[model samples]
Target: MNTVDALVQLSFQVQRILAEAGAEHDLSIVQLRLLGILRDRQPGMLELGQHLGLDKSSITGLVSRAEKRGLVERSPSPHDGRGVLVALTPAGRRLVEVGEAQINRRITELTKRLNATQRKQFTQLASVLVNT
Candidate 1:
């Protein structure tokens, strides 16, 4: 395959691994992403939507579902009373931790055929691609 096709296939494989990891916690990939983003900082709905590349309505629905699962909470944004902030609950934090571990394990397995030098080269190449 060409470089673009190879990259696309790799992306899909990575996404599938993440989806499986999320499923173990009864979370959709989007919900897992929400928890991942909220793990670090409590961002308002608008900011969350922007970071997730979701529209406001989509963000609302995603957050609502996560809220129902007790993985996240919505509260009045401290910076803007009219807006709402999305934060990971303790349960969400724990789930994300486990999900991340699973993902890491799965990805590592995918690279098991590579030697240490190839793995380091791959990591550096991926970092450059991501940063650029």
Candidate 2:
């Protein structure tokens, strides 16, 4: 297969894994992404929306739903009183940990045919592609 086809097929496989993991956790892919994004740092709604490629209203609704589910919290931004920052609650963090484990397990299984060297090479190449 050509590179484009190979990448597309691989993306589909990854998306399937993500869908399965999200379903297991009762999360949509976007919600899973939100949790993943929150695992490290707190960001204001605008930044989150930009990262997620969501518009303001859509992002607001997404955050509201997550907030209602006790998975995330919103607080006044330290830099701007009018701005709100979103963060993962303890429960959200736990969910992310579990979801990540599930994804890792499944992806590792899928890539089991590759030897250690191939896996390392793939990782390096993918990282370069992603970072660019």
| Candidate 2 C-alpha error for residue 6, in Å | 0.5
Q: How many clashing pairs in candidate 2?
A: 0
For candidate 1, give the lDDT. 0.90
Candidate 2: misplaced stretches above 4 Å?
A: none
* Model 1 C-alpha lDDT per residue in residues 6-120, reported as the tens digit of each score: 9999999999998888888787888878888998999998899998999989999999999998889988876776988888889888888888889989999988999999999
Please report the candidate that would top lDDT against the real structure. Answer: 2
Worst 10 residues of 1 by lDDT: 77-86
Q: How high is each candidate's TM-score? A: 0.90, 0.97
Pairs of residues at least 3 apart in sequence or in different chains that clash in candidate 2: none
lDDT, candidate 1, at 56: 88
Candidate 2 — worst ten consecutive residues by lDDT sum?
A: 91-100
